[model samples]
Target: MRVAALDDDVDQLELTKYTLQAVGHDCHVFQDGDSLLRELRRESYDLLVLDWSLPDMSGPEIVQWIRDNLTERIPILFLTNRREERDIVEGLSCGADDFMIKPMRVGELVARVQALLRRVYAEPLPTEQVWGRYKFMPIGRRLEIDGKAVSLTQKEFDIALFLFRNKGRLLSRRHLLESLWGSSNPPGTELMSRSLDTHISRIRSVLNLRPENGYRLSAVYGQGYRLESIGNEDYEADAQLAQSQA
Candidate 1:
């Protein structure tokens, strides 16, 4: 998962980044609210770790800005020095999903982060998952559409599954690469770009992702990709056809 953290204290920022990276997450740190907000405009993160006090803007203010502007419900966790009960209440009320008082313990931080991710992403990934006409068997890394199999490379399966799991969300290219590669600094070379595009194209072709099929896999110009369900019209047609067959 991709995480963005904000903290004015340089040492704390580094520690937080290291902690998240150690647990297989790509972490990006910002020293001020402005830079973090700017990145949020172009990039999409799975979660956010924020400090209550900052050089420019308060964490709560940033949270409010995100809730007001962003359509995606990205999870936000507050790791701050303020330990007051009122502070906790205010943080949650302002839109943070979780709060932890610091001088942070590494173990506690990891646990909190994992718990937040699981709750937000619906983790403990099931062996078999289905969406509309497509069914995924993660253990075997196999995908099926209407009971017929679709061949995919391991990398292609990973990318396709990630996009399906995060359907309706605009995932930035960097986020997709980091999630697949598990590298904080994913190679942004032209070769890597072409590889990703090729994989997406292949998945679309194999899955027959079209509106009549009840799904659409599309590229978001300079952003990345989003898999979305068109509407219930197609779903209704499929149900009627299935009923007629029955």
Candidate 2:
């Protein structure tokens, strides 16, 4: 899992990074809330380790920004020097999932992070996942849409499953590229964007994913993409509205 650790103290930031990395997790350290927020907007993280006192902004303010802007409810753990009960309450109320008063024991911090991850993303991953009229058999690398088998490349299948697993969340382009292409860099060239767009189009067409079909795969302007499930009645109403506009 990718994690972001924020602390104004350089030494503490380094220590946190080392401890998290030692446990086989990719951890990035940030020195200020602004930088962390910038990266958060560009990439998706599984968890965040934040300090209450920052040079730029308070931890609660950062948590509020995350809750307001991010589509996914990423778990956050506060590692701070503030030990007052009020501080803990405020942090939790501001949307942090967990809190730890500093100076923290590295081992306990790691355990707390693990607990939060488990609590937030604990759904058992099965060999197969079924949605509405679609069945995805990961073990067999097969997909059936409304009783009809549709051929898809391995990459296409992986992308489809990723989108489905994170349906209703706006995934940044960099996040998709990293998950699919193994790179964190955003697509820069026309060819890169076209490649991703082509795969998305193919997946939508093969799955018959449209608002009228109770599923919508849409691009989020400057962001990336979001796949959502809608009720049949809502889809029909949207179709009618679109027809009226046309």
Candidate 3:
């Protein structure tokens, strides 16, 4: 999972990042509201931890901006010094899913975040899940297209399953790498980058991911990858992109 933390205090930001990352989440930290907002525009995050006060904007203001501008209901937690009843009410009313007072307790933060995520995204994958023309048997690590089996390496299967499960979400390279290699491993190293690209290429070809197949796995330059499901209308609209790089 990917989490974004916004706090002006350097120590708090580091603590938030470290604590979240320690628990297998890819954490992105920002010291100001503007920077965080800018990132929210380009990338997608599973959750957000925000301080109530900042030099430029209030946490509620940022929450309002997210609720108004973004289509996804990304869970948000308030981590701040404010502990008044009115403050908590305001935070929740403005669209925050959870509220926590700082000096933040690491255990409580993690528990609250995990609980929020579990509640929001609770749908379980079936043993044999069918998605459009593709069927995935996760336990056996097998994939079938139109009732025909397709062979894939273990790594390739992992990557392909991840992309299929998260279709339409813009997954950052760091998030994808962390999913495969764990948070302890460094992302974007030359070797890791090559390996990631290779696996993606293999999966793209093996899956026959194209508009004709009702799916397109696209590589967003300088960001990451997104597997999009397209209809016939979109197929024609994106014909030129079919020949482009993945």
Candidate 4:
């Protein structure tokens, strides 16, 4: 699982990062909440291991942002030194999936995170596939969007999973092609950039939100495309964003 560890404490970040790495989990550490937020905009992780206190923002506040911004449900694990009753209540109320006390236990942490992932994401039956707001029939690879079944081209389905799995990173046509299909595939394969554009068009069509509909697939001008999901439609709606322009 890809995990992000945020803490103002350098030693703690290193310790936790080492532990997570030792267990074969990918981890990214942040020195402060603001930096983490910047990175958060560019990358999404399966689990967030956040320190309860930071100089700029508290862990609970970050958790709330994850719930609001990410279209996919991500597990948040609160790592805090505070053991007070109010602390625990506040963290849980703020959308933390689990709590881990800070002196650190690597094995227990990995086990708990694995268990939470299983409970939250595991499919119930052999023929079922559930991802975000879509469903798939495992046996037939049939996809349903918002309860209505939609026909997806094979490349479209692959592109969908690639987008879902790498929710945060901007993927260029080159990076995308490399990741989806390696050098072995012909240069003019079915998964070319125009093909990617076509797949994205088809996906948007199924959702009833076209590129012209204010729903977006962010074009990074010379770099690549990054999905900007419209779960609560916050693409440019922050009061702070407005005040900055003023």
RMSD in angstroms, all models? Answer: 5.1, 2.7, 3.8, 8.7
Q: Which residue pairs collide, candidate 4?
A: none
Count of residue pairs whose backbone atoms collide, per candidate: 0, 0, 0, 0
lDDT of 1 by residue, 1-246 (tens): 889999999999999999999988889999999999999887899999999999899999999999999888999999999999999999999999999999989999999999999999977367988987888999989998889998899999889889888989999888887788776576665677788888999888888887767788889888888899977786677678878999
How high is each candidate's TM-score?
0.90, 0.86, 0.81, 0.56
Q: What's the ranking of the predictions by lDDT, best on top?
A: 1, 3, 2, 4
- Poorest lDDT segment (10 consecutive residues) of candidate 4: 207-216
Best by TM-score: 1
For residue 209, model 1's alpha carbon misses the true position, in angstroms, by 1.2
Tens-digit per-residue lDDT, 1-246, candidate 4: 567889888998898888887766667789888887776665556678889888988888888998898665778888889888899899989899988886877788878878877776543467665655667664665778778888876767767656654555566555566555643234886547677677777876665443233345555665557765554446346434767999
Question: Model 2, range 7-91, lDDT digits (tens) per residue?
Answer: 9999999999989888877687899999999988767778999999998899999999999998789999999999999999999
Which candidate's lDDT is highest?
1
TM-score of predicted structure 1: 0.90
- Identify the runs in model 2 with alpha carbons over 4 angstroms from their true place: 21-24, 69-71, 122-124, 183-194
Model 3 clash pairs? Answer: none
- The alpha-carbon deviation from the true structure for residue 56 of candidate 4, after best TM-score superposition, in angstroms, is 1.4
- Give the candidates in order of TM-score, highest first: 1, 2, 3, 4
- Superior candidate under TM-score, 1 versus 2: 1
Error of 1 at 26 (Å): 1.3
